[model samples]
Target: MTRAKSGKSGKSGKSSRKSSISEKPSITADSSTAAKPSITSKSSSDKPWPYAAGYDNTPEVLEPAPLTVKGTIPPWLEGALYRSGPGYEIQKGGRVSYRSRYTSNDLRERYKKAEAITGVTFCQRDPCKTAFQKFFTTFKMAAFGGPKMGGTDTNVAVIPTINFPGLMDDPDYKKKKGKAGPRNLVMTTDGNALQELDPITLEPLRLFSYGAIDDSLNASNLAPAHPCVDPDTNEYFTVLLTFGPTALYKVVRIRQSIKGPEYEPDLDVLAEITSPRPTYMHSFCMTKRYVVVCHWQCDFAASGVSVLWYGNAWESFKSHDPNVKASFYVVDRHQGRHVATFEADPYYAFHTINSFDDDGDIVLDIAAYKDHTVIGDYYIENLRNETGGKPPQQAMLRRYRLRNIAEQAALSYGKKGQPQPVPAQIDFQLDESVNFELPSINPSRYLRNYRYAYGVNRSGMNKTLIYDRIIKVDLDKIKSGAKHSSSATFWMEDQCTPSEPVFVPTPNSTEEDDGVLLSIVLDGRRRTGFMLILDAKTMKEIARAEMPEGTVAPHNFHGVYVPNSVAA
Candidate 1:
């Protein structure tokens, strides 16, 4: 199956269940109105700036506390929404509980000490004041221990403990099996460490390693922040990177259920690729039959060892090279081998919206930027600046069609028998108005063709906070050469910024868009946060669970919603 066919309206895929949001008006405020819309407020003489207050040193809710509901929450919505931006909200038994905590509290304190900054970090100060210091720091960092970077800052993505062996050891965790079976959870960052959190309390248990799953993966110190899970097979796929004279990349797979020794998982090395220069990849793409690893133009300097000397990953990257095209390494899952390589224009992307096999071709959709400047856009100083920072940069949605990749891969071994670059054509590009990022889709539609995609809208200009709106787009319209008229919808409120929208489908639903969207919104005016629930089909507000007075939910990167049935 490929992208949905043309002539189908975006709303045609909605669930047959009646929507409570039908009577509510969709939020389509004009630019002027949306910018300065007034919100109810309690007067205060010293209110901190909204963006700064929400992002910097926000308070944490150590205990579960009930929140005030503004409207009716769907009784069918039973789960805890956890965000790596450091918080979670649970709705169960006609009550809602919100909690927030810092996963890297100790790590943050260690950096504050002047002489303790010995490990490589992402964007912290180098700490190497002189050439002699740089030499000693590099020697100490690369000596014996694993990649000493991002200490326990597993604030990126959330994965279920059921995906890995030996993680669900808690008898309580194992006994409380949901429809999918009993499981705990873990949070991950760019480093090798995974912080396991109690699914019920949201308390981090301990720091673990990828090596715990299999000894072969012990050499890897870096892995993709976003790992892929095949919905059909329940297999987990992640790429492990070991930096050395030659950077080595190994694509590994882990089975859903365990059947052997506690420590020994059904893990296997699917493919391996060695490169002289390693590129920084935040995420990758996967379909039912293939796993695609993208090597963009951004590469680490001095074969990645520079991170040791520079004291962080961000300081060691070489600038984007315009002449070098990006490479896509396609691994055939059934055959367990690297089958093809495709080339595309030099561009940087942080997330893959979705992917699927279309006939003989592979269709991959991603949010792309012209260069890597988007990385720097997240600096604390930049994010705190309301109007002085650089012009807001937006990521546009781009679709690539790798035509008959297996056949093209086979031809590479003919005659000269040397691999050549196979061209990957741009099948579609969304208009600039969308400015999409932090994309999400119906969980059931993952690794399969579906019409709707939900994400944040960052097209607003000169604003301190990013992503002022949430959006829903019809992928079928974009594929049918309707870049200008792609069916897109938005939900917005004045003085509120939203995190990524998570789509939770109705149980056993047939329609692709039959679900509700969940997002945590920081209310600028109130200086507090709330859980904003929207109708996935109409992009209209269904209900909201507001945090207690003076409670500010910190800005987060990614999140996951585990239904009570999965694991309470």
Candidate 2:
């Protein structure tokens, strides 16, 4: 991955307007050995201004000790909250821009065609000249890229030549041989391995991989950040995208036996299916009977050679195809066979709420968007503080119903010869809303029909991408023609952004919403971070765990909560 540090001047690059920072006394571990730190420019105003503009540069591995709680910690809520994202920012030499290298030749051809079309020398006019100059300069620099000074590091170990056996033959790999090490570090989006942290102290404990922890399991593949756990069997399931002789999507299941005299856990591959193409996918859906791997229209290069030359996964994605149907590869959980391939209208989804088997018909709920514009809007440069452009279209809670066509075809069309298995038909269900994403459901209700769903909600009319409210949706009421679908909402104060809300179900709870929603909120204006706990039923604040002063928490993507008994 080509990591570059651009625009480190701490300016928004807009007007010369600066936001004032209020001074506060900083907290230190020991006063004897260290001086009393104050919230100075170094601690507050460094990096990008207007904290929500982008991520901060404080990428240290500090163990924040003695967190202060505003309210009492619930006795039943005893577990670790494991959160993961990009943590460290380190500057290294011999960096190469993958985007420039992959697109340089194509860009030159386009430029020459444009010149001939207009019958004018490039950069000879006013507007056209300016546009031509910009395009040429961008491509030229990309073709002859130089080393970047600063970049974020996740502290993940590079696999060297072990993961990619053909790295020696690749031309780009030859250039990066000794000049730079293999860029196999786990990233926020493309997480290669899972890092376990101390739940209470938020201290890094260890890294996890299929090959490292279990000798029986041998697979070198990237682990998706979001994985689903089966409520019935208590088995954890995730898909690993493998590339080599043939691109294979492997479904892995992790089972644990807690009742035996000696506790034992097993990891096994449930299914291995060939993927049609290589694309950047963050999450998938798993129902009670099957696992649905949706091949979203977000396409990377179709071949392994293109993927290797392209370098980064993000650059590999060329464009989003609106006409191509999103392909869903359904695999039976028990049999581990490719049951059917369902096609639906093209759309992109980052998170799925839940999936269930509704009377033999598969129903899946996800946060869907029309295109991939929302992703580019997440870049630090395009943030509201920098560009001040309108926020990307919000993702809505869209329900898709996949009807079993095989049964319908057998009855309607009749069996002429060997009856062909019908493809599952998909259609939209329920009215859409534009205020939801980063969805969460009660873990106990997973793989089964449930009533409620919780997620981060954006404040109405706010022009930024930060989520300012947490909302609870009554799925039953929404389906029944209720005018208002939201049952409750907990809106944070202005300038405070909330992370993905995690639902923790109460022990022996009967009601669906009998739980708590845990989220880490950053007060961009105050330069402080806190853990907000809310009542899942009413969306009311229960407690707030505030970190020590001078502690900066970077934005996190996903998190999981493990009960005390389970952690033990």
Which residue segments of model 2 deviate by more than 4 Å?
Answer: 1-54, 59-64, 71-73, 85-223, 244-246, 256-268, 384-387, 405-433, 484-490
lDDT of 2 by residue, 5-27 (tens): 11111111221111111101011
* Cand. 1 Cα-lDDT: 0.64
Give TM-scores for every candidate, taking all chains together and pairing residue i with residue i.
0.83, 0.66
Q: What shift in Å separates residue 52 of candidate 2 from its native position after superposition?
A: 2.3
Model 1 regions lying over 4 Å from their true place: 1-48, 112-118, 126-182, 256-263, 412-418, 483-486
TM-score of 1: 0.83
lDDT of each: 0.64, 0.50
Error of 2 at 409 (Å): 12
Give all candidate RMSDs, comma-separated.
11.0, 14.8
